[model samples]
Target: MSDDPYGVDVVACKSRQQRLLAEMVEHGLEWVVLTRRESVQWLTGAYVGPLFAPAAAMNTEGRVTLVLPSRKTSLTVAADEVLPYEEKWCSTLRDEQRAASNTVMMSALPIKLRHVGGEWSQLGPDLLADCEGNVINIEPTIFRLRRQKDNDELRMLRRANDANRAMYKLAREIVEPGVNELDVYNELHAVAVQKLGEALTYFGQDFRSNARGGLPRDRKIEAGELYILDLGVGFRGYYSDNARTLAVGGEPSAKQVLAWERVSEVFPLVESTVRPGASCKQLFEEVQSLLDKSKPWVFNHHLGHGVGLAPHEGPHLNPSWDDTFAEGEFFTAEPGLYHEELRAGVRLEENYVVTATGCEKLTDYPLGL
Candidate 1:
């Protein structure tokens, strides 16, 4: 079951589907079939099963079915499957054979071409045998529409941010000298399970001491060493990712502190530059310039990336990326400096949402040693 308190309104889901159907009509398409899980969820708010399995038990032979409009105007499913459509909605459950027949029936209904999304390559043979019409893919159209978030999605993303912060706080509280990397991972996992319950979708912890190498792996923290904590936590399906470098008992070395300060300063510069209509490439170049001055220990990754339904979404802050920042987009601004000679690194990341004027920082943690 989804954590969404509204319980996946079938009416609202149908409204979304109808809008897509209208788009199809405008494009000269008469009927369309959706197959991918994400596309199916966006269109009908219905969850189908066994998409990633073979054709035997899971029925990967294009068993999942959806038709835009029909004379009967009802939802249909296999006997083993459960229909998500509300009873009030024009939905009916039918056997798999009946469902496939409805697809043929809908294709014959005054529609022009048949548009299909997801597993189309697999279902093409079967569909072509039954309906003789032009078949086109709708993956790109659906992707473009779903990439940008809505207000309700932003609310779920905010909750994910809150859960992510709680996990980070737990890491800080339990991280100390003599703590193993897996130990910290377990501690933070416990906090997430206790606070968020089943709402937590994912949790990961990568801990590495500044000694040996900065690469996160199975290692134990020692006094006077640096520990890096990288975590991603989620609520519903939205995700939030954050990373922090911690100092053990004593003060961090001068080199580590300097690296931390440089990355910290760069974060605000990146955040301030993010706004609707700003070029992501230009902003990345500006941030890179600041790192060049503090050269010899340069950061080697993208300045940031979008964070929402997927941990690494879009509008990446990199020199090669040319996408423009848009309002309502949420992303992370993480900058780090690694010095192999010193075997130490410093990185600080924060989440931000692009606004009309500028941007809003989602994470408010302090960024010093």
Candidate 2:
């Protein structure tokens, strides 16, 4: 039995490498090195921690070489060749890991060509020196290509968001008066582990009570307070971003109900306005207009953002970046209002994948207040 957590499809990773090789050929580049944490995982499917960074070098001829710590050799990866370097062994320690990594990187990618394509900013000093200070930054191009979802990527993302559905249902059950937000956070984590049948590679986003959004605080939640749980979950390298809000007690004030109703209306509005080639900036402005005209409760945040390896990816529904929606892209639409008067406000978010016509919502939890 292959105990590969997250069920990473090796075939898909091979396709991703082919895509990058095509990109290198288009740019007239000989080789490309990827060292960014996300890039390493995206290309090779081996999750490296912050302490060490892995590098993937792909040639235009579809040859990919990965350099990672020797300890992680048992993990499955999608590289034609792997250059393993030492880090630590038994009780003894090796202080020469970085130097060893640099040496292997030099052997892995000895190209000092002028037309090199790689993540220039994320390079280690040793790897940077080997690139000869002329590596062109192709991060944007890679991110652009990432917007389109593959079947394997979608499968992994759905498994992650499925955990979100279970957690949100539990949130509705457990959020009540005098309950600590931290306790709720812990309970949700437990629910996720139960649902996924394994440990989560990532679980984040807001978990707070009587507040707009933040990490779960130690304070107890009062009855009439709003508890917002914006879930950002990761199964392997893929992530699912969605949110749900619950009234602390079973009962909600009239105004609180009204705020929930108004916030809930934004979802349909978003669904109708979103499609392939739709302007994200215009979508933000239009949605903001709808919420602004509704009075005191405000939608003061990015309307939505794409979800993938990074929680906040491109095709953003915000004014900062004028991105347009693309078919096969996964994203989130979050509309909210924060005020101590309405028991610290209400927010509702949903994850969706853009379809040929409109969008298919990934999260199916109840949207009740």
On TM-score, the candidate that comes out on top is 2
Error of 2 at 329 (Å): 0.9
Candidate 2 runs further than 4 Å off: 1-5, 91-99, 130-133
In TM-score terms, candidate 1 sits at 0.74
The estimated TM-scores of all candidates read 0.74, 0.93
Q: Local error of candidate 1 at 87, Å?
A: 21
Residue 157 shift from truth in candidate 2, angstroms? 1.2
The pairs that clash in candidate 1 are: 75-91, 75-92
Candidate 1 ranges beyond 4 A from true positions: 1-28, 44-113, 117-134, 211-217
**lDDT at residue 74 of model 2 (Cα atoms):** 68
> Using lDDT as the measure, which candidate wins?
2
Whole-model lDDT values for every prediction: 0.61, 0.81
